[model samples]
Target: MTVEYRPIVPKIKRFKILVIKIVFIVLGRAFQSASQHDEEIKREISSWRDGFTLIMKVMPDGPYMGLEKKNNMLEFKGSKLKQADLEIYFRNVESAFMIMTPQMGSHQAFAEKRMSIKGDLGIATAFTRALVIVMSVLYPEFIVKRLVKRVPPLTIKRAGLRVWLYTLGIVLGR
Candidate 1:
């Protein structure tokens, strides 16, 4: 008797896709809410096209998630749009989870070769900066400091306001 080969690729792919979608949806909500309340973040993203899209994938050719900025509003969805201005690829699911979950800072991940970027480098850099700012809004100062290379100066009042707004956005499903 001979054993038949079984393929686990499809199940693995589906799992990766689900993770990517969940990560991006949370990020999209945070970014959109931050932009609405933070002048600096709004200014940073204003230069981007109204319908600019960014895709992040776990591998060069793998399940991906997309973030679309339209009419100054940001939305995240799974696997839409044929092209994007920027595409960030993490070496694997573990690498993606590390950065997305704040287990490692994005800058560290880039330096360690866990992540790679395609498309315009400038656009990617700007987007990364915006993400850092959004993180500051979403997390406490101590946590944000650990996640970013250099935390921007923030007054206690401003930080408190940001945290409140971010929480409100999440509560209201903004």
Candidate 2:
């Protein structure tokens, strides 16, 4: 009996995982920056107790990103994979990518059965709002229009925030 040769699936998955990992790295930094700078994000997190942790990870496998609230600002826990107060689990890499990119939003992903949550719904809601605020600042107007239900007004301040994200947030992770 000849065994089936299935080399492609593993390679493809590894590639998808890598792409997702990079996206998560940038995402962690963006979240941290927004928490520190955006007034909306600050207000959103104000209710959360210090040390609040959230993790976003793909299901049935490895690779995860953790974010925690400390000193009233969000911090990226790059090497962390611990139990969080709110954990957002993606059924697969495609689902995570779609949600992470402007291709789709978190609400759509959940409704489509591509995502799941384990923890407090209120925290998740607040986190989603914070993420929406961050994404709007990071992406351009065209992409943001599609990523969010309502596009934030194009202003000099928003443009500057995007600039800071590129030069400092994504780069130095500040």
Any residue pairs clashing in model 1, and if so which?
Answer: none
For model 1, residues 1-174, the per-residue Cα lDDT tens digits are: 999999775446566556666766667666656666667777877888887888878775666777778778666644775567788889987788778777788899999999899888888888888888877766677888888988876767558647666567654435
lDDT of 2 by residue, 11-124 (tens): 457776787888889999888876787777899999999998889988867578999999988999974757799999999888877776558877677788888899999889
Computed on alpha carbons, the lDDT of every model, listed in order, comes to 0.74, 0.81
Best by TM-score: 2
Tally clashes: model 2: 0
Weakest ten-residue segment in model 1 by summed lDDT = 9-18
Model 1, residue 63: distance off in Å is 5.0
